[model samples]
Target: MSLYRVFDIAGTGMSAQSVRLNTTASNVANADSVSSSVETTYRARHPVFAAELSKAAAHQESAGVRVVGIVESEKPLTPEYAPNHPMADDNGFIYKSNVNVIEEMTNMVSANRSYQTNVRVADMAKQMLNQTLRLGQS
Candidate 1:
């Protein structure tokens, strides 16, 4: 509604993107991990985001983005037949993390761009407020 609200909205946007980036980084970091058992294998994690509404009855205006939760992927892990691998299970098969590097990299780029956009929005709002104050002085 106001220029000040712009800063708040942008800040929330940045924070949400930060969380997304962190989760994406985590998923990427564990992408190469291997485990002998399905229970011990790492799964790709994704952040769940929800829109915060300002009013429930009146005009539906977004307050900001909120991270509701982080969920692990349900996709089955990669089962590789590594007979020589030390971590192989009884069946000579090892389970690799379900994280796809390309997908995670794409998510990282998107989050980075979103974060940068929020920063630019905040900066523009600050400049506008400063110019408005200068106008009143003259």
Candidate 2:
């Protein structure tokens, strides 16, 4: 595979990780949100990733990562009895978001590391290209 292809693959990976980080941030932001009903409650959102196999094959014959979609978590919401709360339902039960703080934090850390790795990969590719050009000049 060409050196430039390395940049392309790494760039795609960085983009996917950016999306994942964004979704994880959103999930964390809404973790404490409460609603009167399940329909109105905030569900933990996650980014779905898929392999860009064809493009990867065209570039280096390897699989590359891609963000497929952002999906809401299916876990049941937490119900709490808050009779005086404004958003409480008829049964005085408020539905809280299903987002787990620890999980979101872990995801954030992972996405951050993945993004950093991609950046390093792209930087290395750039250095290699520069070296190749220098060799041609010599």
Candidate 3:
């Protein structure tokens, strides 16, 4: 692998974390939403990622991350009987979104730190390349 491949790997890491952040944000935004039916209720979404590894058979050894897909949680939604609520169904029940705020917040924190770590890695790679060029100058 080339020294420059570090940047590409770090970029993919950052991108995967960005997708995590976006999905977490979306889940948080819909956390308090109420729906008239279970079918229409919002569910938590999570991004799935896969790692791509270059094979030595092809004389490449760079590894990177990719988003496989985003999946909705299979957990059941909460239904409450609220006859007075405006959005209640004919049965006087409202379905609450299955997003857990605490869990989503934790995901946000983790993703933020991962993104920061990837930034530092890319920065370190750039510094190393610069130092090598400086050595040549000297």
Candidate 4:
């Protein structure tokens, strides 16, 4: 594969990480959301990713990352007995979001690192290309 493909691969990786960061932030921001019914309670959402692999072995193309979709966590929502709460249901229960703040924070850090790594890779690839071009000046 050409050095130019490195930039494309790194760009896709950065894009995937960005999507992950956004979803993680959304999950954290809605961590305290409360609802009277389970249907309305906010659940943690996660981004799905897939690798764009090559089918032909002769070319040996570079693979890139792609986001599949964002899906909500299947874990059960937290139900509390807060009869006095204004958002309590008729049966004196309130549903809380299933988002785990600690986990979300970890995910955020990981996504940030991945994004930074992709940036570094792109930078290195650019430098390599530039150096290759500079060889002609010698």
Pairs that collide in candidate 1 are none
TM agreement with the true structure for every prediction? 0.92, 0.93, 0.94, 0.94
lDDT per residue as tens, model 1, 1-138: 788878878998999999999999999999999999999999999999887774522664547888899999999999999999999999999999999999999999999999999999999999999999999999
C-alpha positional error of residue 52 in candidate 2 after TM-score superposition, expressed in Å = 1.3
User: What local distance difference test score does each model get?
Assistant: 0.93, 0.90, 0.93, 0.94
Give the per-residue lDDT digits (tens) of candidate 4, residues 74-113: 9999999999999999999999999999999999999999
Alpha carbon deviation, residue 50, candidate 1 (Å): 0.7
The number of residue pairs in model 2 that clash at the backbone is 0
Candidate 2, residues 2-115, lDDT tens digits: the string is 887788789889999999999999999999999999899999998898877887657656467878788889999999999999989999999999999999999999999999
Q: Candidate 4: give the clashing pairs.
A: none
- Residue 27: error of model 1 in Å? 0.9
Task: Please tell me which model should have the higher lDDT, number 2 or number 4.
Answer: 4
Off by over 4 Å in 1: 55-62
Cα deviation in Å at residue 138, candidate 1? 0.6
Q: Report clashes for each candidate as comma-separated counts.
A: 0, 0, 0, 0
Error of 1 at 93 (Å): 1.1
Residue 79 shift from truth in candidate 2, angstroms: 0.3
- List the candidate 3 regions with Cα displacement exceeding 4 Å: 54-61
For candidate 4, give the lDDT: 0.94
